[model samples]
Each structure stands twice: as C-alpha cells, then as structure tokens.
Target: MLWPFGTTWRPMRQKIRGTVDLRWLTARSWTTKWYPQGIDLGTWRGRRTLAVSWFRQDRMRRHVASRIAFVDLERSRHLDVALAIEGDDGELVPAQIHAGGLAWFGDRLFVAATGQGIWEFDLAALRRVRGPIARRLAGSRGRGWRAVALVAVRTRVHPVALRCSYLGRVFDDAGEPLRRVLIGEYRADENGRIGEFVVPGGPDDRFERVDLYTPGIANMQGAVRWGDHHLVSQSDEQRAGVLWSGHRDSLSRDRIPLPIGCEDLALDLEARLLWSLGEHPWRRVVRGIPFAQLGFDA
Candidate 1:
C-alpha cells in the first residue's frame, strides 16, 4: 500500500514492481504540451486499458483546450492517436470542454469538463462505435456542470454517479437541485457555480441526492471517492492546495503539494494511486501519490 520515499515514510510491500515513471507523449509541437489531467482503468473485451484526458493552453491566443487520450494500462503504451478525443469531439462534444476530472462506473467513463459540462462515454462504444453519449437533462443548459468528480455508488446492477461543483448546487440523476455542503470561499457572485452533481440513481428515472458541496470554493480542481469517503481538492488566488472530504464533513484550509497546478485530479482505484498534471509548458511531468497517506484521515 505504501512506497519508500526516502526516510519520510515507511515502506509497504507493493504488488506491482518497477519505480513509477511518467512517460510523456505529444501529437504535435504547440506552445502548450498536453498533460494527463485524469485517468480511468477498466476492462474491454477481456483486455485492460487506461483512458486519459489532456489540459492544453494556446500561448499565442491564451486560449485553453481540453482533450481525451487513452493508453493500455496493461501495456502502459498510448492508444492509437486517432481514437483519442480532443475538445468538443470527445466526451464534451457540442461544447468547448476543458476536462478537469474523470472516473469509471461499470464499463462507462464519466468526465468532468469545467464550464462546458459532464459527459458519460460508453466504453464499449469507444471500441465498437468510436463515440460516446452526452447525457444532458431535459431543459438543462449544462451551466455549472464543469469541474465534476465522479464516484461509484454501491447498489444493485449498475453503479450510481456522484458529482460536485465549484458553484453551490448539487443534482441527482434527473438534474434536480440537491442540498449543498461546504467547499471553500467564493469571490464572484456566481463563483459558487456547481461544477458536478453526484447521487444514488437507477436506470428507471429514479434517483436520490445524498451529499452536496456549498458555494464558496472558487474552482474545484480534483476529487476522489475512497470507500464511502469523498476527498475534493481546490485552490485559490491567495492560497493553493485545498482538500475537502464529503464523507467526513471536513476541509483542509492549508495547501498541499501537487504534482501539477490543476483543478482536476484522477485516481487509480486498483493501485490506490492518485495522478495529476501540471500546466502547459510543464505538462511533461505527471505526479503520482499514494492515497493511503494523504494525511487527512477520518
């Protein structure tokens, strides 16, 4: 469960061998290089695979673009570049999405595209039909749907979805407003815009809202669901590295060290590892941390 990091922490036997090394890949040489903001591991056609999304910035125009890429976790090699989705073409189709987070539920991939909206991609279709579906609620405009963190809910049949946001409101499966919990401080009137909403829901139009985050956090960056607990991470202009836990009703006002400066986070559930990407020119470095040693325990 733990790896030796100098003399700071004790070493726990690892099931997988080889030191953790981050490999960088590029499709083109732009001013901004792509970074791995989020990742998901799952099985398809009896083969294990890894899915990743990129955070990019256009130095010339100062514009930002988010793209999705996949690699074989079993093989640890990048997937065919053609299959990866960039900007609106991938999960955030029809919208200019900047992916902030990602998670897996059953065989489906859920991605959080800050400002644009959340998307649910069919893993089977990615290999079968080569496309995903954007599950938009009726009359919903995808407002505050960005900055999403997805968690798997325990239930019968398929897993449920849980989403949180930088803005206040949380939602159930039907996109109905749910209660809110504390995230952090807010600046603008709409700074507390809801980014993601997660709750217990079923396939038959039945859903229930469980927990929510209150407005205040300017921008929610990263989130992870461990067992029944949810850890949300954020940063601000004054301070950086804020972590909040929904399952424990706790928050860390102090900043923590992050591999990259991003509002998004990804978790490798099986390995109990966390992954983050840095900003544009520095996107080559992907940071990995152990979940068991986050220091915020319930």
Candidate 2:
C-alpha cells in the first residue's frame, strides 16, 4: 500500500456506479479544466439530485464554460443531467467559468471561483443570478486568491465563531500555504467573485498557520460540511482521492482514502452515505464508504 496514513478502511455500506457518457474525462480541480470541484445534496429544477460543480465545461474540448450538473440520487438507476449554465441575457452557452466550492443559502447558490468572486444563481431557472451585494470586507484592495469550499450554516456548525453564519475557504496554488497549509476560519463577507479570506479562528482555537501534510495531500480541491466538522478532498494527482476531516482550527487529522480525485464531498446523512465525486463522471464515477465508517459518530 503506498498510503502512509491509516490502512484500516472503516466498515460502511458501499455503493458505486456512474453514468456512461462517451464524453471526455473532465470534472476535476487544480489539475485540469474538465475537473469538477464541489458536491451537494439539493434540488435542481425542483427535482432532488446529487449536485456537482464542474470547473469548466467540457464540450468534447475544454473551454470557458462553468456548470452545476445533477445525478438522480433518488432513483434506482440515477440519471446524469449535465447542463452548462446559461446567461440571464438569453444566451444558451456558458456565461462564466472557473467554479469551485458551492453552498445554498436562502434563494441563491453561492459558488466559489478561482479568480472571480462568488457567483450566485437561481437554481430553478438555471441562470446567473447576481444580487445588489457589496461589502467593505477588504476595502479597495481585495484578495483575488483562488477559493475552494464553503459552509453556510444556520448556527455555528462547528466549534468556531462566525460573523454572518456563512464561512468560505480559498486555495493557494502558488505554493505559499502548501507547506504549512493555511487552516484558518474566515467570516462571511460580500467581497464577491471568490470572496476575500480573513483570519478569525479566535484566540484559543486560532490557526493562522499550521503545519499539515508532511508530504502534502496533493493539490487542495473542494470541501463540504459534515455535522459540526468539515471534510476536505485532497486530490492525489488525478488518480486517487484522500479525504481530510477536522475542524477549521484542527489541522492534523484523519486521512481517509477515496476513489479517483474526488474534487468535493457530499454526505447523505439519512443513508449514511458519503458521495465522493471526481472528474470524468460523464464516463465513470467510483463511489465508496459511508460517513459513519470514518470512525466518527455524528
């Protein structure tokens, strides 16, 4: 086993399947444009689905297209409906690109961008929905760094403080936070298009900088909130997936192996299933493990 972390795969019911689309291999993050980034259990077009965020659209060839496709999770044989987000101006092509972590708050879906600020959309219409939102979160000089996962909880989900009950994270592909792995908790701000990240992990639980991953956990991808904790998917190149679970303040935590480079994670708590999504789901998707099998009780 090449894995230096824990080898004992926790006992949980596992189910794996994928939609056999003859499309090219895409839907990953920090590696290719076809790579997908985030996953969530929500409704699309008024139908329940396993929502997955694609970095850029793969119209056989990669281009400037962003999307949030769906998998029919409620059905016995799930259907994959891949739709590139269209502009509100009535154009049928993708209006934006470079999408990352996604979270739903009220009537809007908040999407993290690599360079752009968070993009909001009205799920039912499948169109770009921008609100009259602006905040002096970072004054004139804003942080244009790339962002990853997000969490918009009604209450403080984890043992952390919050400004607006909405927390988001940004990634560093420039190799700045890779060695130390910036694991800090930031407050919610309206610094749109991949909002600015500020350090506010509090005094006792503050983690301005923490040394995580001695050998590194590949390129940091996307994440999702599980109960009071967050599970971050660390892409092992583009072949395998490693999941790192912990609170924002806690860095050194559990490393659970997953299939393909799961750009994001979605937990179906009712079924005790952990939906680990990767790129190339149009071709194949490897599913495994339950949320409880990770040795953590919810």
Candidate 3:
C-alpha cells in the first residue's frame, strides 16, 4: 500500500454560414495569469492546475522541453503538458499507470507502483512503454516487491535509485520469505547497467517491523532528490506528517507543521521551493514550503 498523492475550461465559438467556421473561447478565458505567491497553485483552483514536475531542472531536456506531469491515483494515470510553471498551456499528454512515486533518470520517467514495482515512461513517446518488475528485489522475504516511494538520489558514493517498500513480508530471488518490509537502496552506474542492492533492515530484522512503525511513525509515501539527500514524506494516519532528510546516513528528520498529511514531495533546486502532495482529496500539489527551512538546499 503506497500513499501520498489531483482541470479545465472552454471558450465561446462563432459559426460561419454553410461549413460553419467557429471561433472558440474568449481571450480572457484563454488567458493565464500566474499569481506571484503560491495561492493559485493548489487544488483550490479545482480544475485549473494541481502539481508541477520536479524534473524541470534535470539535464535531460534536449529534444523536448520539460513538462509538469500530474499523476492521478484513482484515475490510474498521469498528464504531461508543455509547461505549467508558465501556466497550463500546451499539448496534454496522458499516460496509463498507478503512479506512486515519480523521478526522472535521464530521459525516462520512473513512477513507483504500490507493491507492483517501478514503471518507466518514455518522454519522447510520452507514454508508459515498460514497467520492469523487479519480482525479487533486494532484501525481500518473499512477498514479491512493492515500491511505495522512489527517488534518484545523487549521493557522494553513487547515483542510486532509493526506494521504500510497503510489503509486510520480504522475499528473495527464489521467493523465500526473509523479513517484513525492506528499505532498499539499488544503484546503477552512469552507463545504466544493473548494480547492487543494499537492504538496511533497521539494525535488526527481528525488531524491524515494530521499530519502523510506532505511534507517531508513518510510511514513506513521497520522496524527492533534494541536494545530496533524499527528502522523504511520511504520513501518519492520525497526525499531520513527517519528513525525513538523509543520504546514506540519517542526517535528520522533522515534522511538518501543518495538520494536512503530505504524500509525494517535489523539490525544485532551481526554484528553491519544496512542494508536498497531500493525501486523499489531493491538495497543495503546487504551493511550496521553503527549501532552506526544510534543509533540502544550500
């Protein structure tokens, strides 16, 4: 079970005789104005716009410029337009998938699937071409593999895909049970060949289950590559939310002040703001918190 993680208008038209040539929507209706503040960048707008992509600053937009892709969980898909930062105006590209976590590696978009695996969407094609299922993920006790949240962390050691699992039982290659839930770090080199999997079992496997989930504890629902660390958004069913900041070693963790729970987090180093996605009736997909305050940037 992965957590974390939400429109439109028409214009008037005029018809000409015979063939009936039509002129659409008023200029005011087609016009887009970005509020200087983060006011209009939320679900409050309802159908205007919701979330922005975190890959805008990534160095992979050669042929196509970056786009803000919004992943709709219930709908089981995502939307990619030309640009949202400027305003939602461009071609609307829709892709099918149960998107959990999202990250951009080069030109491919990786979306974590709840307990399914990872989905790789091609930017050029603007659709889901493959969902390479890692049936036997590292540190599994035999429950296949579920990806709750995923991020491409650029660590001092290597650039790795850090993902969190939501499975209750872990499994190995041959489907042998090991433990319950595995926080894994899988790394591939710059060339993109398969690499190592390091499963950190919270110091002890026997107590991992109990230790990872306490009263105030939450499951990782959203993750982002913030600076040299992974900014993870954890949601507590009762409480507000918690955010963890770390790389290989646990640097620090903090509680989100708002009572609203945060799902997937997107940090724009260029914009210097961290956007946290809200749960259920999706909200706050655009409005952001200070990156410096969150300790995700310089």
Lowest summed lDDT window (length 10), candidate 3: 33-42
lDDT of 2 by residue, 201-284 (tens): 333432233222222333555544443355656556556667777654453446556667455555555455666656644323
Estimated TM-score for each candidate: 0.55, 0.52, 0.39
Candidate 2 clashes: the total is 13
Q: Clashes per prediction? A: 15, 13, 13
- Report how far residue 277 has shifted in candidate 3, in Å: 0.5
| Of 2 and 3, the candidate ranking higher by lDDT | 2
Q: Name the better of 2 and 3 by TM-score.
A: 2
* Best-performing candidate as measured by TM-score: 1
Q: What is the C-alpha RMSD of each candidate to the true structure, in Å?
A: 12.5, 15.4, 19.9
lDDT of 1 by residue, 121-199 (tens): 5444332121122212111224443322111111222122333222122223333323322122223342543223343
Q: Report the Cα lDDT for residue 85, model 3.
A: 12
Q: Candidate 3, which segments miss by more than 4 Å at Cα? A: 1-97, 127-217, 225-228, 246-248, 255-259, 282-285, 295-298
Give me the displacement of residue 88 in model 2, in angstroms.
Answer: 9.3
The lDDT per prediction is 0.41, 0.41, 0.32
Over the stretch 1-298, how does candidate 3's per-residue lDDT look in tens digits?
Answer: 1222212222224332321112212322122211000111222113222233322111332212123434332232234332211115632322222234444433333443333344333433322111221111111123433422122111111112334221112223333333322222212221211112222333231222222211122355544332234455566654666776665245357743422444555444434555554432222223356656664446
Residue 65 error, candidate 3, Å? 26
